[model samples]
Target: MTTRPGRGRPKASDGADRRTALVDAARRLFAERGFAATSVRAVAREAGVDAALVSHYFGDKQGLLVATMALPVDPAARIREVLDGGRDGLGERLVRTFTETWDPHEDVIAALLRTAMTGDPEQAPALQLARAVLVVGVREQLQGPDADGRAALVAAQVVGLAVTRYVARLPHVRDLTPGDLARVYGPAVQALVDGN
Candidate 1:
Protein backbone atom coordinates (compact mmCIF):
# COMPACT_ATOMS: atom_id res chain seq x y z
CA MET A 1 0.00 0.00 0.00
CA THR A 2 1.02 3.62 -0.39
CA THR A 3 3.10 5.10 2.40
CA ARG A 4 3.88 8.75 3.10
CA PRO A 5 7.16 10.12 1.88
CA GLY A 6 10.19 10.19 4.16
CA ARG A 7 13.34 12.28 3.72
CA GLY A 8 14.28 12.37 0.06
CA ARG A 9 15.66 14.97 -2.36
CA PRO A 10 13.08 17.12 -4.09
CA LYS A 11 12.41 16.51 -7.76
CA ALA A 12 14.59 18.77 -9.91
CA SER A 13 12.76 21.47 -11.82
CA ASP A 14 14.77 20.96 -14.96
CA GLY A 15 14.05 22.92 -18.13
CA ALA A 16 15.32 25.78 -20.27
CA ASP A 17 14.23 28.34 -17.71
CA ARG A 18 15.89 26.48 -14.86
CA ARG A 19 19.09 26.10 -16.89
CA THR A 20 19.02 29.80 -17.73
CA ALA A 21 18.51 30.70 -14.09
CA LEU A 22 21.40 28.49 -13.06
CA VAL A 23 23.58 30.04 -15.77
CA ASP A 24 22.61 33.53 -14.71
CA ALA A 25 23.28 32.70 -11.09
CA ALA A 26 26.54 31.06 -12.01
CA ARG A 27 27.67 34.09 -14.04
CA ARG A 28 27.04 36.39 -11.10
CA LEU A 29 28.76 34.17 -8.57
CA PHE A 30 31.66 33.41 -10.89
CA ALA A 31 32.26 37.08 -11.58
CA GLU A 32 31.79 38.17 -7.97
CA ARG A 33 33.58 35.29 -6.26
CA GLY A 34 35.99 34.16 -9.00
CA PHE A 35 35.80 30.65 -10.51
CA ALA A 36 38.03 28.90 -7.96
CA ALA A 37 36.09 30.25 -5.01
CA THR A 38 32.68 29.41 -6.52
CA SER A 39 31.16 25.96 -5.97
CA VAL A 40 28.43 23.89 -7.67
CA ARG A 41 26.30 23.95 -4.51
CA ALA A 42 26.77 27.70 -4.29
CA VAL A 43 25.53 28.13 -7.87
CA ALA A 44 22.54 25.86 -7.17
CA ARG A 45 21.71 27.80 -4.05
CA GLU A 46 22.01 31.06 -5.91
CA ALA A 47 19.68 29.70 -8.57
CA GLY A 48 17.14 28.61 -5.93
CA VAL A 49 17.34 24.95 -6.78
CA ASP A 50 18.65 21.69 -5.37
CA ALA A 51 22.38 21.12 -5.62
CA ALA A 52 21.91 17.90 -7.58
CA LEU A 53 20.36 19.94 -10.33
CA VAL A 54 23.64 21.71 -10.93
CA SER A 55 25.28 18.37 -11.59
CA HIS A 56 22.30 17.13 -13.56
CA TYR A 57 22.24 20.18 -15.77
CA PHE A 58 25.92 21.02 -16.06
CA GLY A 59 27.73 17.77 -15.14
CA ASP A 60 30.02 19.49 -12.60
CA LYS A 61 31.61 22.77 -11.57
CA GLN A 62 33.84 22.88 -14.64
CA GLY A 63 30.86 22.17 -16.83
CA LEU A 64 28.99 24.96 -15.11
CA LEU A 65 31.97 27.22 -15.69
CA VAL A 66 31.88 26.36 -19.39
CA ALA A 67 28.20 27.16 -19.60
CA THR A 68 28.63 30.54 -17.94
CA MET A 69 31.65 31.84 -19.86
CA ALA A 70 31.08 35.22 -21.52
CA LEU A 71 32.36 34.28 -24.98
CA PRO A 72 29.42 34.21 -27.42
CA VAL A 73 31.02 31.60 -29.68
CA ASP A 74 33.32 28.63 -29.22
CA PRO A 75 36.83 29.94 -29.76
CA ALA A 76 38.00 26.43 -30.61
CA ALA A 77 35.38 25.95 -33.28
CA ARG A 78 36.23 29.32 -34.73
CA ILE A 79 39.89 28.32 -34.83
CA ARG A 80 38.98 25.07 -36.54
CA GLU A 81 37.09 26.97 -39.20
CA VAL A 82 40.05 29.23 -39.75
CA LEU A 83 42.30 26.19 -40.07
CA ASP A 84 39.91 24.58 -42.53
CA GLY A 85 40.39 27.35 -45.05
CA GLY A 86 44.13 26.58 -45.07
CA ARG A 87 47.16 28.53 -43.86
CA ASP A 88 47.35 31.27 -46.50
CA GLY A 89 45.27 33.75 -44.51
CA LEU A 90 45.01 31.71 -41.34
CA GLY A 91 46.37 34.48 -39.18
CA GLU A 92 43.87 36.95 -40.52
CA ARG A 93 40.98 34.57 -39.90
CA LEU A 94 42.08 33.94 -36.35
CA VAL A 95 42.65 37.59 -35.55
CA ARG A 96 39.50 38.73 -37.34
CA THR A 97 37.30 36.36 -35.38
CA PHE A 98 38.98 37.35 -32.14
CA THR A 99 38.69 41.07 -32.78
CA GLU A 100 35.12 40.82 -33.98
CA THR A 101 33.91 38.54 -31.19
CA TRP A 102 35.77 40.29 -28.38
CA ASP A 103 35.52 43.94 -29.39
CA PRO A 104 31.95 44.66 -28.38
CA HIS A 105 32.27 42.53 -25.26
CA GLU A 106 35.66 43.96 -24.32
CA ASP A 107 34.66 45.29 -20.93
CA VAL A 108 33.43 41.95 -19.63
CA ILE A 109 36.34 40.08 -21.19
CA ALA A 110 38.77 42.67 -19.85
CA ALA A 111 37.53 42.29 -16.30
CA LEU A 112 37.71 38.50 -16.41
CA LEU A 113 41.12 38.55 -18.07
CA ARG A 114 42.46 41.19 -15.70
CA THR A 115 41.33 39.28 -12.66
CA ALA A 116 42.88 36.07 -13.89
CA MET A 117 46.22 37.61 -14.93
CA THR A 118 46.74 40.05 -12.08
CA GLY A 119 49.59 37.93 -10.60
CA ASP A 120 48.29 38.59 -7.12
CA PRO A 121 48.60 35.59 -4.83
CA GLU A 122 44.84 35.53 -4.38
CA GLN A 123 44.31 35.46 -8.16
CA ALA A 124 46.50 32.46 -8.96
CA PRO A 125 43.75 29.87 -8.80
CA ALA A 126 41.57 31.89 -11.10
CA LEU A 127 44.51 32.19 -13.46
CA GLN A 128 44.88 28.40 -13.64
CA LEU A 129 41.20 27.84 -14.28
CA ALA A 130 41.13 30.55 -16.92
CA ARG A 131 44.09 29.01 -18.72
CA ALA A 132 42.37 25.62 -18.74
CA VAL A 133 38.97 26.72 -19.96
CA LEU A 134 39.96 29.44 -22.40
CA VAL A 135 42.63 27.78 -24.53
CA VAL A 136 42.80 24.03 -23.96
CA GLY A 137 41.41 23.41 -27.41
CA VAL A 138 44.11 25.45 -29.05
CA ARG A 139 46.59 23.19 -27.31
CA GLU A 140 44.90 20.08 -28.73
CA GLN A 141 44.68 21.45 -32.24
CA LEU A 142 48.39 22.13 -32.31
CA GLN A 143 48.79 18.33 -31.86
CA GLY A 144 52.52 17.90 -31.34
CA PRO A 145 55.22 17.51 -28.69
CA ASP A 146 55.17 21.22 -27.99
CA ALA A 147 51.46 21.78 -28.56
CA ASP A 148 50.95 23.40 -25.20
CA GLY A 149 53.78 25.79 -25.81
CA ARG A 150 52.50 26.67 -29.26
CA ALA A 151 48.98 27.26 -28.00
CA ALA A 152 50.32 29.40 -25.18
CA LEU A 153 52.24 31.49 -27.65
CA VAL A 154 49.11 31.94 -29.74
CA ALA A 155 47.17 32.93 -26.63
CA ALA A 156 49.82 35.44 -25.64
CA GLN A 157 49.42 37.21 -28.96
CA VAL A 158 45.67 37.39 -28.72
CA VAL A 159 45.45 38.19 -25.03
CA GLY A 160 48.12 40.83 -25.33
CA LEU A 161 46.23 42.49 -28.15
CA ALA A 162 42.97 42.29 -26.24
CA VAL A 163 44.52 43.82 -23.15
CA THR A 164 46.35 46.59 -24.98
CA ARG A 165 43.36 47.42 -27.14
CA TYR A 166 40.46 46.92 -24.79
CA VAL A 167 41.72 47.03 -21.23
CA ALA A 168 44.58 49.47 -21.45
CA ARG A 169 43.06 51.24 -24.46
CA LEU A 170 46.39 52.13 -25.96
CA PRO A 171 46.52 54.90 -28.59
CA HIS A 172 47.42 53.10 -31.80
CA VAL A 173 45.83 49.73 -31.04
CA ARG A 174 42.64 51.28 -29.73
CA ASP A 175 42.46 53.41 -32.84
CA LEU A 176 42.80 50.43 -35.18
CA THR A 177 39.76 48.72 -36.68
CA PRO A 178 39.32 44.95 -36.41
CA GLY A 179 40.64 44.49 -39.95
CA ASP A 180 43.64 46.68 -39.27
CA LEU A 181 44.35 44.88 -36.03
CA ALA A 182 43.99 41.52 -37.74
CA ARG A 183 46.42 42.56 -40.45
CA VAL A 184 49.00 43.57 -37.87
CA TYR A 185 48.43 40.75 -35.35
CA GLY A 186 47.48 37.80 -37.54
CA PRO A 187 50.92 36.77 -38.84
CA ALA A 188 52.39 36.30 -35.35
CA VAL A 189 49.55 34.03 -34.33
CA GLN A 190 49.90 32.12 -37.59
CA ALA A 191 53.56 31.56 -36.86
CA LEU A 192 52.67 29.90 -33.56
CA VAL A 193 49.91 27.82 -35.15
CA ASP A 194 52.36 26.73 -37.84
CA GLY A 195 55.02 25.89 -35.25
CA ASN A 196 57.36 28.25 -37.08
Candidate 2:
Protein backbone atom coordinates (compact mmCIF):
# COMPACT_ATOMS: atom_id res chain seq x y z
CA MET A 1 0.00 0.00 0.00
CA THR A 2 1.17 3.55 -0.80
CA THR A 3 0.75 6.60 1.40
CA ARG A 4 -0.87 9.84 0.23
CA PRO A 5 1.11 12.96 -0.66
CA GLY A 6 1.69 16.10 1.51
CA ARG A 7 0.86 14.20 4.69
CA GLY A 8 4.07 15.09 6.47
CA ARG A 9 7.04 17.49 6.43
CA PRO A 10 7.71 18.27 2.80
CA LYS A 11 10.68 16.92 0.90
CA ALA A 12 13.41 19.31 -0.26
CA SER A 13 11.74 19.79 -3.61
CA ASP A 14 8.56 20.76 -1.85
CA GLY A 15 10.25 23.28 0.44
CA ALA A 16 9.26 26.28 -1.63
CA ASP A 17 5.62 25.22 -1.76
CA ARG A 18 5.55 24.60 1.97
CA ARG A 19 6.96 28.03 2.65
CA THR A 20 4.47 29.62 0.29
CA ALA A 21 1.64 27.91 2.05
CA LEU A 22 2.73 29.31 5.40
CA VAL A 23 3.06 32.83 4.00
CA ASP A 24 -0.34 32.63 2.30
CA ALA A 25 -1.90 31.35 5.49
CA ALA A 26 -0.30 34.09 7.55
CA ARG A 27 -1.38 36.78 5.12
CA ARG A 28 -5.00 35.62 5.13
CA LEU A 29 -5.18 35.26 8.89
CA PHE A 30 -3.41 38.55 9.47
CA ALA A 31 -6.04 40.22 7.39
CA GLU A 32 -9.07 38.45 8.81
CA ARG A 33 -7.96 38.14 12.44
CA GLY A 34 -5.37 40.92 12.65
CA PHE A 35 -1.65 40.22 13.17
CA ALA A 36 -1.50 40.13 16.95
CA ALA A 37 -4.43 37.79 17.13
CA THR A 38 -2.92 35.22 14.79
CA SER A 39 -0.65 32.47 16.08
CA VAL A 40 2.13 30.39 14.56
CA ARG A 41 0.26 27.21 15.38
CA ALA A 42 -2.85 28.49 13.68
CA VAL A 43 -0.87 29.47 10.62
CA ALA A 44 0.71 26.04 10.51
CA ARG A 45 -2.67 24.41 10.80
CA GLU A 46 -4.05 26.67 8.12
CA ALA A 47 -1.14 25.81 5.85
CA GLY A 48 -1.28 22.11 6.70
CA VAL A 49 2.27 22.02 8.02
CA ASP A 50 3.95 21.43 11.33
CA ALA A 51 4.22 24.35 13.71
CA ALA A 52 7.98 23.89 13.85
CA LEU A 53 8.20 24.95 10.23
CA VAL A 54 7.16 28.47 11.13
CA SER A 55 10.06 28.73 13.56
CA HIS A 56 12.42 27.06 11.13
CA TYR A 57 11.41 29.20 8.17
CA PHE A 58 10.67 32.59 9.75
CA GLY A 59 12.52 32.52 13.12
CA ASP A 60 9.32 33.77 14.78
CA LYS A 61 5.94 35.34 14.19
CA GLN A 62 7.49 38.73 13.53
CA GLY A 63 9.69 37.27 10.82
CA LEU A 64 6.63 35.60 9.33
CA LEU A 65 4.92 39.00 9.34
CA VAL A 66 7.79 40.46 7.36
CA ALA A 67 7.72 37.56 4.96
CA THR A 68 4.05 38.25 4.24
CA MET A 69 5.05 41.57 2.67
CA ALA A 70 6.44 39.39 -0.18
CA LEU A 71 8.51 41.98 -1.97
CA PRO A 72 10.92 40.69 -4.61
CA VAL A 73 13.88 42.14 -2.70
CA ASP A 74 14.57 42.23 1.00
CA PRO A 75 13.73 45.65 2.41
CA ALA A 76 16.39 45.89 5.12
CA ALA A 77 19.13 44.72 2.78
CA ARG A 78 18.01 47.23 0.13
CA ILE A 79 17.85 49.96 2.75
CA ARG A 80 21.47 49.17 3.61
CA GLU A 81 22.42 49.43 -0.05
CA VAL A 82 21.02 52.99 -0.24
CA LEU A 83 22.54 53.94 3.09
CA ASP A 84 25.91 52.75 1.78
CA GLY A 85 25.58 55.24 -1.11
CA GLY A 86 25.91 57.99 1.55
CA ARG A 87 24.07 61.26 2.04
CA ASP A 88 24.65 62.56 -1.49
CA GLY A 89 21.36 62.14 -3.38
CA LEU A 90 20.11 59.92 -0.56
CA GLY A 91 16.56 61.23 -0.90
CA GLU A 92 16.34 60.36 -4.57
CA ARG A 93 17.80 56.98 -3.86
CA LEU A 94 15.16 56.41 -1.19
CA VAL A 95 12.31 57.44 -3.47
CA ARG A 96 13.68 55.22 -6.21
CA THR A 97 14.04 52.32 -3.81
CA PHE A 98 10.51 52.67 -2.41
CA THR A 99 8.95 52.83 -5.86
CA GLU A 100 10.96 49.96 -7.24
CA THR A 101 10.20 47.78 -4.27
CA TRP A 102 6.44 48.30 -4.12
CA ASP A 103 5.43 49.04 -7.70
CA PRO A 104 5.26 45.41 -8.72
CA HIS A 105 3.56 44.34 -5.49
CA GLU A 106 1.04 47.15 -5.11
CA ASP A 107 -1.79 44.95 -3.86
CA VAL A 108 0.31 43.44 -1.07
CA ILE A 109 2.01 46.67 -0.05
CA ALA A 110 -1.23 48.65 -0.22
CA ALA A 111 -2.90 46.27 2.20
CA LEU A 112 0.03 46.73 4.56
CA LEU A 113 -0.26 50.49 4.29
CA ARG A 114 -3.98 50.36 5.05
CA THR A 115 -3.30 48.19 8.09
CA ALA A 116 -0.81 50.81 9.22
CA MET A 117 -3.13 53.72 8.52
CA THR A 118 -6.12 52.20 10.32
CA GLY A 119 -4.60 50.12 13.09
CA ASP A 120 -2.66 51.18 16.16
CA PRO A 121 1.02 50.52 15.63
CA GLU A 122 1.37 49.09 19.13
CA GLN A 123 -1.19 46.37 18.44
CA ALA A 124 -0.79 45.91 14.70
CA PRO A 125 1.74 43.47 13.30
CA ALA A 126 1.79 45.17 9.91
CA LEU A 127 2.61 48.54 11.50
CA GLN A 128 5.20 46.91 13.73
CA LEU A 129 6.68 45.27 10.67
CA ALA A 130 6.81 48.67 8.93
CA ARG A 131 8.58 50.28 11.86
CA ALA A 132 10.96 47.38 12.20
CA VAL A 133 11.53 47.07 8.46
CA LEU A 134 11.80 50.76 7.46
CA VAL A 135 11.92 53.01 10.53
CA VAL A 136 14.15 50.95 12.81
CA GLY A 137 16.12 49.68 9.84
CA VAL A 138 16.91 53.27 8.86
CA ARG A 139 17.51 54.44 12.40
CA GLU A 140 19.95 51.67 13.22
CA GLN A 141 22.11 52.43 10.18
CA LEU A 142 22.61 56.12 10.87
CA GLN A 143 24.66 58.04 13.43
CA GLY A 144 24.41 61.30 15.45
CA PRO A 145 22.00 62.40 18.18
CA ASP A 146 19.25 63.00 15.64
CA ALA A 147 19.35 59.57 14.01
CA ASP A 148 16.07 58.49 15.57
CA GLY A 149 14.30 61.68 14.52
CA ARG A 150 15.76 61.49 11.03
CA ALA A 151 14.71 57.89 10.55
CA ALA A 152 11.17 58.64 11.74
CA LEU A 153 10.94 61.59 9.35
CA VAL A 154 12.17 59.52 6.44
CA ALA A 155 9.74 56.75 7.32
CA ALA A 156 6.90 59.25 7.24
CA GLN A 157 7.92 60.45 3.79
CA VAL A 158 8.16 56.91 2.46
CA VAL A 159 4.79 55.99 3.98
CA GLY A 160 3.09 59.05 2.50
CA LEU A 161 4.53 58.30 -0.91
CA ALA A 162 3.22 54.75 -0.66
CA VAL A 163 -0.27 55.76 0.39
CA THR A 164 -0.62 58.49 -2.22
CA ARG A 165 1.04 56.79 -5.13
CA TYR A 166 0.13 53.15 -4.61
CA VAL A 167 -2.85 52.94 -2.28
CA ALA A 168 -4.67 56.03 -3.45
CA ARG A 169 -3.36 55.74 -7.01
CA LEU A 170 -3.28 59.51 -7.29
CA PRO A 171 -3.16 60.53 -10.94
CA HIS A 172 -0.33 63.03 -10.73
CA VAL A 173 2.00 61.04 -8.48
CA ARG A 174 1.22 57.64 -9.95
CA ASP A 175 1.68 58.85 -13.49
CA LEU A 176 5.27 59.96 -12.93
CA THR A 177 8.16 57.64 -13.67
CA PRO A 178 10.25 56.42 -10.77
CA GLY A 179 13.12 58.69 -11.79
CA ASP A 180 10.78 61.66 -12.04
CA LEU A 181 9.23 61.08 -8.64
CA ALA A 182 12.66 60.68 -7.11
CA ARG A 183 13.77 64.01 -8.47
CA VAL A 184 10.66 65.72 -7.13
CA TYR A 185 10.59 64.04 -3.68
CA GLY A 186 14.22 63.25 -3.02
CA PRO A 187 15.17 66.78 -2.01
CA ALA A 188 12.64 66.78 0.80
CA VAL A 189 13.83 63.41 2.11
CA GLN A 190 17.44 64.44 1.64
CA ALA A 191 16.75 67.57 3.65
CA LEU A 192 15.57 65.44 6.52
CA VAL A 193 18.65 63.22 6.32
CA ASP A 194 20.88 66.31 6.20
CA GLY A 195 18.96 67.69 9.20
CA ASN A 196 18.11 70.90 7.38
Candidate 3:
Protein backbone atom coordinates (compact mmCIF):
# COMPACT_ATOMS: atom_id res chain seq x y z
CA MET A 1 0.00 0.00 0.00
CA THR A 2 1.71 3.12 -1.29
CA THR A 3 0.67 6.48 0.10
CA ARG A 4 1.33 10.09 -0.90
CA PRO A 5 4.43 11.72 0.58
CA GLY A 6 2.56 13.50 3.32
CA ARG A 7 1.30 11.55 6.27
CA GLY A 8 -0.51 13.10 9.24
CA ARG A 9 -0.43 16.74 8.20
CA PRO A 10 -1.94 18.22 5.07
CA LYS A 11 0.45 18.92 2.22
CA ALA A 12 2.38 22.23 2.11
CA SER A 13 0.44 23.12 -1.03
CA ASP A 14 -2.34 24.20 1.30
CA GLY A 15 -0.02 26.30 3.43
CA ALA A 16 -0.41 29.41 1.34
CA ASP A 17 -4.18 28.98 1.24
CA ARG A 18 -4.22 28.37 4.97
CA ARG A 19 -2.16 31.47 5.67
CA THR A 20 -4.53 33.55 3.56
CA ALA A 21 -7.45 32.10 5.44
CA LEU A 22 -5.78 32.94 8.72
CA VAL A 23 -5.24 36.55 7.72
CA ASP A 24 -8.85 36.92 6.59
CA ALA A 25 -10.07 35.48 9.85
CA ALA A 26 -7.76 37.75 11.77
CA ARG A 27 -9.00 40.85 9.94
CA ARG A 28 -12.62 40.07 10.64
CA LEU A 29 -11.95 39.30 14.26
CA PHE A 30 -9.70 42.29 14.78
CA ALA A 31 -12.31 44.61 13.35
CA GLU A 32 -15.07 43.09 15.44
CA ARG A 33 -13.16 42.76 18.70
CA GLY A 34 -10.51 45.43 18.39
CA PHE A 35 -6.85 44.42 18.44
CA ALA A 36 -6.54 44.24 22.21
CA ALA A 37 -9.39 41.83 22.62
CA THR A 38 -8.43 39.43 19.87
CA SER A 39 -6.07 36.52 20.57
CA VAL A 40 -3.78 34.55 18.28
CA ARG A 41 -5.21 31.31 19.53
CA ALA A 42 -8.70 32.52 18.73
CA VAL A 43 -7.57 33.53 15.28
CA ALA A 44 -6.12 30.09 14.74
CA ARG A 45 -9.35 28.51 15.91
CA GLU A 46 -11.30 30.68 13.53
CA ALA A 47 -8.99 29.66 10.74
CA GLY A 48 -9.20 25.97 11.69
CA VAL A 49 -5.49 25.71 12.16
CA ASP A 50 -3.26 24.81 15.07
CA ALA A 51 -2.43 27.67 17.39
CA ALA A 52 1.27 27.19 16.72
CA LEU A 53 0.59 27.60 13.06
CA VAL A 54 -0.50 31.15 13.70
CA SER A 55 2.76 31.93 15.46
CA HIS A 56 4.72 30.15 12.79
CA TYR A 57 3.05 32.05 10.02
CA PHE A 58 2.80 35.52 11.59
CA GLY A 59 5.34 35.48 14.45
CA ASP A 60 2.85 37.00 16.90
CA LYS A 61 -0.41 38.86 17.25
CA GLN A 62 1.15 42.05 15.97
CA GLY A 63 2.52 40.33 12.93
CA LEU A 64 -0.87 38.85 12.22
CA LEU A 65 -2.52 42.27 12.52
CA VAL A 66 -0.03 43.86 10.14
CA ALA A 67 -0.47 41.05 7.70
CA THR A 68 -4.23 41.21 8.01
CA MET A 69 -4.35 44.96 7.36
CA ALA A 70 -2.19 44.97 4.24
CA LEU A 71 -3.65 46.97 1.40
CA PRO A 72 -4.63 45.25 -1.81
CA VAL A 73 -3.28 48.16 -3.80
CA ASP A 74 0.41 48.58 -4.33
CA PRO A 75 1.41 51.64 -2.31
CA ALA A 76 4.65 52.31 -4.19
CA ALA A 77 2.81 52.29 -7.49
CA ARG A 78 0.15 54.59 -6.08
CA ILE A 79 2.74 56.96 -4.66
CA ARG A 80 4.56 57.09 -7.98
CA GLU A 81 1.37 57.98 -9.75
CA VAL A 82 0.66 60.79 -7.29
CA LEU A 83 4.18 62.22 -7.45
CA ASP A 84 4.56 61.98 -11.21
CA GLY A 85 3.76 65.54 -12.28
CA GLY A 86 5.62 68.79 -11.59
CA ARG A 87 6.78 68.96 -7.98
CA ASP A 88 5.14 72.38 -7.59
CA GLY A 89 1.77 70.78 -8.25
CA LEU A 90 2.37 68.19 -5.55
CA GLY A 91 -0.23 69.36 -3.04
CA GLU A 92 -3.14 69.28 -5.47
CA ARG A 93 -1.74 66.08 -6.78
CA LEU A 94 -1.59 64.52 -3.31
CA VAL A 95 -5.11 65.55 -2.33
CA ARG A 96 -6.49 64.16 -5.55
CA THR A 97 -4.33 61.11 -5.22
CA PHE A 98 -5.64 60.12 -1.79
CA THR A 99 -9.23 61.06 -2.60
CA GLU A 100 -9.11 58.64 -5.48
CA THR A 101 -7.17 55.92 -3.70
CA TRP A 102 -8.96 55.88 -0.35
CA ASP A 103 -12.26 54.52 -1.57
CA PRO A 104 -14.15 53.25 1.49
CA HIS A 105 -15.25 50.16 -0.39
CA GLU A 106 -11.98 49.42 -2.18
CA ASP A 107 -9.59 49.24 0.81
CA VAL A 108 -10.04 49.26 4.57
CA ILE A 109 -7.53 52.05 5.06
CA ALA A 110 -9.91 53.93 7.34
CA ALA A 111 -10.71 50.82 9.28
CA LEU A 112 -7.03 50.31 9.89
CA LEU A 113 -6.77 53.88 11.12
CA ARG A 114 -9.67 53.32 13.48
CA THR A 115 -7.94 50.36 15.05
CA ALA A 116 -4.56 52.09 15.09
CA MET A 117 -5.75 54.61 17.66
CA THR A 118 -6.30 51.89 20.22
CA GLY A 119 -2.58 51.75 21.08
CA ASP A 120 -2.78 48.04 21.67
CA PRO A 121 0.32 45.95 21.06
CA GLU A 122 -1.49 44.10 18.35
CA GLN A 123 -2.59 47.35 16.78
CA ALA A 124 0.85 48.92 17.04
CA PRO A 125 2.34 46.62 14.47
CA ALA A 126 -0.15 47.64 11.87
CA LEU A 127 0.20 51.31 12.77
CA GLN A 128 3.97 51.07 12.53
CA LEU A 129 3.61 49.34 9.21
CA ALA A 130 1.45 52.17 7.89
CA ARG A 131 3.73 54.90 9.22
CA ALA A 132 6.83 53.29 7.81
CA VAL A 133 5.31 52.58 4.44
CA LEU A 134 3.67 55.98 4.04
CA VAL A 135 6.17 58.29 5.75
CA VAL A 136 9.15 56.70 4.12
CA GLY A 137 7.57 56.90 0.73
CA VAL A 138 6.89 60.61 1.18
CA ARG A 139 10.27 61.18 2.75
CA GLU A 140 12.00 59.54 -0.16
CA GLN A 141 10.54 61.99 -2.64
CA LEU A 142 11.10 64.88 -0.29
CA GLN A 143 14.71 64.15 0.65
CA GLY A 144 16.70 66.63 -1.40
CA PRO A 145 18.12 70.15 -1.21
CA ASP A 146 14.76 71.73 -1.97
CA ALA A 147 12.33 68.97 -1.03
CA ASP A 148 13.44 67.72 2.40
CA GLY A 149 11.38 70.16 4.42
CA ARG A 150 8.54 70.14 1.96
CA ALA A 151 8.23 66.40 2.11
CA ALA A 152 7.94 66.29 5.88
CA LEU A 153 5.39 69.10 5.79
CA VAL A 154 3.36 67.44 3.11
CA ALA A 155 3.36 64.13 4.95
CA ALA A 156 2.04 65.80 8.09
CA GLN A 157 -0.73 67.52 6.16
CA VAL A 158 -1.70 64.33 4.43
CA VAL A 159 -1.93 62.53 7.75
CA GLY A 160 -4.06 65.30 9.21
CA LEU A 161 -6.41 65.22 6.24
CA ALA A 162 -6.82 61.50 6.51
CA VAL A 163 -7.62 61.76 10.20
CA THR A 164 -10.14 64.53 9.73
CA ARG A 165 -11.81 63.19 6.63
CA TYR A 166 -11.89 59.51 7.38
CA VAL A 167 -11.13 58.67 10.99
CA ALA A 168 -12.96 61.57 12.60
CA ARG A 169 -15.45 61.99 9.79
CA LEU A 170 -15.57 65.75 10.34
CA PRO A 171 -18.74 66.65 8.50
CA HIS A 172 -17.66 69.99 7.07
CA VAL A 173 -14.28 68.68 6.17
CA ARG A 174 -15.55 65.44 4.76
CA ASP A 175 -18.37 67.13 2.90
CA LEU A 176 -16.03 69.11 0.67
CA THR A 177 -16.30 68.07 -2.94
CA PRO A 178 -13.11 66.92 -4.61
CA GLY A 179 -12.87 70.14 -6.64
CA ASP A 180 -13.45 72.26 -3.58
CA LEU A 181 -10.92 70.20 -1.70
CA ALA A 182 -8.38 70.92 -4.36
CA ARG A 183 -9.12 74.62 -4.24
CA VAL A 184 -9.21 74.98 -0.44
CA TYR A 185 -6.96 72.29 0.91
CA GLY A 186 -4.68 72.12 -2.05
CA PRO A 187 -2.70 75.15 -0.94
CA ALA A 188 -2.06 73.63 2.47
CA VAL A 189 -0.75 70.48 0.89
CA GLN A 190 1.27 72.57 -1.52
CA ALA A 191 2.62 74.60 1.36
CA LEU A 192 3.75 71.40 2.94
CA VAL A 193 5.52 70.27 -0.20
CA ASP A 194 6.66 73.78 -1.07
CA GLY A 195 8.04 74.62 2.38
CA ASN A 196 5.71 77.55 2.84
Q: Using TM-score as the measure, which candidate wins?
A: 3
Question: Which candidate wins on lDDT?
Answer: 2
Candidate 2 — what's its lDDT? Answer: 0.77
Stretches off by above 4 angstroms in model 3 are: 1-33, 38-67, 105-107, 115-147
Between candidates 2 and 3, the lDDT winner: 2
Each prediction's TM-score against the native?
0.52, 0.59, 0.60
Question: Residue 54 error for model 2, in Å?
Answer: 19
**Residue 139 CA displacement from its true place in model 2, Å:** 3.6
Residue-wise lDDT of candidate 1 within 73-133, one digit each (tens)? 5555555666577646767787888788777766556556655654354534544554565
Note the residue pairs that clash in candidate 1: none
Residues 1-196, model 3: lDDT tens digits: 2222343666665444778878888877776677778888888888777778788888887778778778776655667777667567777877877776775432256657667777554645645655566566666656346565566666677778877886577897788866678778998876666555
Q: What TM-score would you give candidate 1 relative to the actual structure?
A: 0.52
Worst 10 contiguous positions by lDDT, candidate 2? 1-10
